[model samples]
Target: MADLKQGSASHQHEAAAVIQKHFRRYQAQKRYKQQQSATSTIQQHASRFLARRQAARDNEQEQRAARFQAVMSRHHERIQQLELEKRAIKQLGAGELEAWQARREAAATTIQAHWRGSRQRQQLKLSHPALATLRPVACSSPQPADEPSCSTRPISSKVPSNHPLLHSVTAAGVTGLHAEPSTASVAAWPAHRAGLEQQPSSASVCSGVGYSSRAAAMHGALRGEASSCLSAEASRLSAVGAAAQQPADAPRRTAALPAARRMVLERQVQLRTDAFKAAPNALAAARATQQESDQRLVHLLEQHTAAAAERLKAAQRRQKLLQDAEALHSQLQQLPQLSQLPDNVTGAHFALPGACGARAQRSRQAHALALAEAKVGSKWWLPLKALNQQLRDAAAAAEQDAGSTSGSASKAAAGALWGAAGSTGLLQQDWQQQELMWKDSWQRIREEEQQRPGLQELMQQDQALRPHVVIEQELSSESSWHAASMQ
Candidate 1:
């Protein structure tokens, strides 16, 4: 039994040794795996750290390059701007700059001068000369010391019958066809003669007869008193021919006058006789022309006055129409509930039976009246049409909803509210008032048209006369009498 126990103990000891040996081997293998893992983790951490450092350096290099490029671009743009400025400064010289400035100033001055001259000419045409004073100068001889200076002489209230001006006034009878000057008068013989020399006779006549008459008076005075009568007779005959002659012929005429006074007088008498023979026909034609012009002027004045009155009437009518429309709009705006009604009337609240029917009837009536009003030509036509359309649409929707669902409590309540609003008679009253206003406007417009002249009459009168009338040039009664005597 001892021997068996010893063997068993030895087997147990060997089994324990083997088991312990396997356990040590397993522990060593786990330790080796742990060490390898630790080495690999250290290697990976070092590689990752190196990679992060390299990426950071690369990013810094890229950023520096981008910043350098940005700096270079900015510097390039600044340098270009500086170079362009330098070139521009070099291109513009002092003399050229001054010349450009001078041209600008000259152009401005020329434009200003042109406008000023036009304004001055307009002013001269509008100006009325209250008095004309002429200072005469003796062309043939110097005046004696005892004679009064023409400049110092007081203006005469009336032209004297024996005045030298009479001869010329009679010679050039056409000169008298001007608005008579005021009471003040003075002899400005030399200035008048100078003006006659400078200006064409036709232009002078158109400018003012006062100037022409004064010029004629100076011309008669220059011929001397001894030959004044003969010269005056000759002047009447030659006046027309003289006016027609060029300014260059004036010197020649003046030079020849001293050599052949009698021959000139005879020729003038013959011319005067011939002019007298033709005077009746010319006078008849002028009278006919003047009559036609007077008729035309009257017609044109009537047409213009009628047109202005019509325009005024039209403007008044438009204003009245606008006022009526605004009043109607105001009445509509006052009904807040009606205006607030939904586009789809099925959503409206009514509380009683037949309420929807009543509301629909009122809406239809309002819509009908609005539609009628829209037919009128007014600025409010579109708005009125829109309002009427909305009412019609709401009425239609209500009718459709009532047909689709005959017993909706909410719809009945909405219809009751609309009916209550209509039953108050406010909407009907507003409509009646608007209708009355429209009728009154129409009546007023009709009355105005009735009181004014008919378009046909005005059109006929316009067609018979000219659309535009020009005033006929007529000689004054005094001038006509003088012309008859000369003829």
Candidate 2:
């Protein structure tokens, strides 16, 4: 056992070393690839930025030219406001736009309030079972005419003490059973029960049956034993009911009965109550049978469902993998010849920086809020905006100081003796396991761009083509053009 332990430890160490070797190799390859791509990625980002800046400059020039047009619009609006004032229309009075908006807001609020009230009332009706009784009930329409019905009134009577199954239903149907039996059932079942309850007067009752049953119910883990307990209790109950029906003078000799007869009698037990069988007002027997059968099936299936579901999921996963493999094999010619690295440095290694940097966030919410409150009619309003901006920049600088790897790297190198095992070294995992072992993300994105539909074909057909636009000059010059009616 000592040798075996040593051998296993050696094997584990060997596995760890091999894993580290592969990880280091992958890391070196990744770093080299990043170095190669950094130039191009940075260039692309720089070009995009410069293009956007140029576009913004052009937009500013166009806006300057449109200023004269805006002045003309203001003049046109003043003329319309003056003309409306002369009319003295109620809706067209002072603060006309505000009034229209207020009326619209009021109408919307009223509609929403009415909808909520109606919904709440409906929900209240559904929630209360008593309300269902007050609502007029028609005779049941179709489907299982023999099924139990409570008629217009729910059951509220007390059931026999011997019948536990029917007890709760008789009181208030809280057990979700029939409130009333079907037309075929006997409303009074005690007479039939009285016959089955008879047992030999000389025989003794089973001792501690009630205590054993109660204890088992409270703590028993065995399901089959619980059912046996139920059967035993039923037989005991039937014998009890029979005792009341028989005369005290009547004699029953247990010794006179044949061995076979006695054996059959001993084994015989009533499975159900008379009320439960051939229910006249409902299919109580069928429902009970179905319920038992369902419970049994559920119990049986519960043992195997988890294993079966796991197998099914595994099979589906394998099928998907195979399908993906086949598709890739078929489209080999269209696929990328080489894997490209992402220039984005965001990865698990940044987690420490994120945690450490939280002390210095961009928000100066309290200061900004104070400035906002004091801004109205203050000479320092212009300076308040600048103060808010200055605080934000200061916070950014502090965050850079807190979260940066540059400062930490120097400190870490100084303490290299104590911190030899780095985040990606002996302490942490081999690599972040992503698609194609961290390969597919960049390649797939590139492939999607290259194979993007329509644009390439359109460029080939007419490379000089540019989409033409015809803006309505009147609409741009006048905001009220939206209210224009067609002739």
Candidate 3:
């Protein structure tokens, strides 16, 4: 009975173990079915949520589009209004009649002054030095009896035969029934004697022996009467005396007196003085005319400048107004238009596409799909974990078959990671080589620094960077491991 009982107990224990195993499998299956149902429900919910969100986004987009269209239309209208106002302002800017008149008057004044100055210069050049004495005076002073007639104009000394003054003076000088003076006789006057005795001098009294002493001698000789002849006579005495005693107020007389002769004589001294007096007045008048011309020119330049300035200011003002109008139009255009224009909405079109919120939704979808895929085969984390373990084992395994075929693909993927590990060893070798080279270079630099001023300071710079090499190596190895696991 005891043997039978023990056997039964063992059998019962085996049965119970079988039952527990079946129950655990059933529970796992049930859990899997529930997870699948939950996943389906989540997918359904996600699809509906995406549809709703897409519709809302589409609606918001439609509203935005409507607002944009309204804003553009209002902006265009405002631009038209501003254009009309600008045209009216332009009309008001025209018709400056007073300004035009001022410009014309100023131009005329400048032209007249320029002409006057030109005429004065021409007159100055044409008038001979001796003839300058004959110029008219605009004002006058009372004349003494001793003064030559102010009206007497100077004529050419060597008058041409056809000259009008020649005939008048010739007939007058010869009116008393005497032979006309020959040109040779007038020219025979001693030039050297004229030069020496031109001014009052003691030698002025001297005369040649055959010359008459007085005018009576010359008159008697001419009339064939000896009583009128004399050894010497004052040369041109009566002509000089008549010239000297002429009234300054006498009427204008066109005379043929030699200008050169009168210039050298004492007779026409008052005329020369009057000409000198008038010269300054003429020059002053010319200067005044020039000044007036300059003023007019400046005024015209100012007008032109003012006009240009006004145009620039107007352009700037217009530019500012246009900018302001554009900004306002943009603002007015941007004001919500969906609220203002609902009729523009078309048939059931999604206002916004799912693309707007696709990132989070797609991520959720991906998670769902990954979960389903994991149930069918293995979890993403399991494969990745296996792959990482295989790669690590392959990296460390001394026996070829330990991870050979098992992690071959994983090893290929982890080649960069293993290469980085190997590169760390290579980096250690490279660092050792670099350290040797640097030590030698540093010694050379130190020697050079000993010979050169300030080199020590340069070499000592960035002295804090030495320990970073170890830190970078550790970080690089850690990054490589993390990256390999992720892959």
Candidate 4:
């Protein structure tokens, strides 16, 4: 494998070039196919979009053409209607004036109703100039013939169609159509019309028309029609009545369109400033305060440091006292407690602060000094000192005298002292054993006092928890005989 790898390494660059060339060709072909597919997708989407847009445009054009056609048809129809109306008006007799009034009044009423309904549906008081344009209209529904109009216009008795009054009203249209009147009332036409108006309603009059009032008024000036003249006069009267009724300062219903409300927002910006910035001495005062605080802090820190040092010194003093006491206690153990010296056994003497043995914790190492004076006193301090003094003297005398008498004296005194010390050691051990036994008994008693309730108090558990069934039965002969015997 190593040889093959070594050989292949030499051709690595050439193989990589060939691999890269093929990969590049593959990538180019893939990219070309992808781009072509994407282009085809884009073309399909564009064509669909254009088709839809064109279809929409065509539909819109068709709808517009239909609406235009409808509008033109209506326009032509209205024109034809107006032309027919003109001819009809030219031929209208006095009776036909009522019909024209009815139609005009209906138009005005329709405009008012549309205005009112529009306002109500929108829930708004719309101020329209168009509302004021048509102030007068009347109903055309049937009314009883005996009833009177709201204006209290008197009704005249029915007159023949050929009545002279009719001829008088139609005089301008065609002359001599009536019997030659000896004398005619100039107001006959007006009185006749007023009574005819009263025949239409009791409570309401087919009052006047506001329907294309200008056009109606212009057409009323035709020279040949009596109905046209009356219509024009009626329109003039209605206008005068409307002007009288509406006050100049009448409050109008105004429209509240969402667009008309103010859309622009007003803004105001205010920056907060501090009076402290205006004062030149503020910084100086602040620095002085900070310096004062720092000084106070330094003073407090010094006090704390002194206090800490005192506490540490006190702790070290305590540790020194404990070490001294422990060392002296150990030295005292080596000294004989006898009142006299023994002849047989000599006591072991140790120098001051003798070995208390080495401890693994070296937190305090003052004991490294072997002969350093360590002060610790106990109840046996004097006795221990005296024993040490006697031993030193005995050794000195033995060295000086070198006689059998001196040696014998040292031995007797040391032996008696050590014997007493042995007696005292026996008492100490005995007391320690007794103390341990008492402590153990006390611990046992305390443990026995902690009673567990469940172990002792689970009485009548079965009868209290289990279900029971009543058994009705005769007593057995043996149980009855036992009960009789007990009684």
What Cα-based lDDT does every candidate model obtain?
0.48, 0.42, 0.47, 0.42
Q: Which ten residues in a row have the lowest lDDT in candidate 1?
A: 128-137
Which sections of candidate 2 miss by over 4 Å? 1-56, 63-113, 122-169, 172-487
Q: Mind giving the per-residue lDDT tens digits that candidate 2 earns over 364-424?
A: 2333333333222223233333433443344445446666656455334323321221221
TM-score per candidate, chains pooled: 0.22, 0.14, 0.20, 0.19
lDDT per residue as tens, model 4, 1-487 = 4434544563475466446456646755765696677767766766786799799999999999999999999999999999998898878886778887899999998989666545442321122221122222222444333221111211112224553333443453423322221212322444555765654321121123222332232222222222322443333334334444566776742222121111100000000011112223444555677699999999999999999999999999999999998788556444432223333322123323432422211111222111111112212133333443444454445535756656656555434433323332232244345445544654564464354223223224423432331111123334555676797
How many residue pairs clash in all the candidates, one count each? 13, 12, 19, 14
Per TM-score, what order, best first?
1, 3, 4, 2
TM-score of 2: 0.14
Which candidate ranks first by TM-score, i.e. highest?
1
By summed lDDT, which 10 consecutive residues of candidate 3 come out lowest? 225-234
All models, RMSD in angstroms: 46.4, 40.6, 31.1, 47.2
Q: With candidate 2 superimposed using the best TM-score fit, by how many Å does residue 431's alpha carbon deviate from the native?
A: 52
The model with the greater TM-score, 2 or 3, is 3
Of the candidates shown, which would achieve the greatest lDDT relative to the real structure?
1
Stretches > 4 Å off in candidate 1: 1-261, 336-487
C-alpha displacement of 222 in model 1, angstroms?
22
- Candidate 4 displacement at residue 429 in angstroms: 78
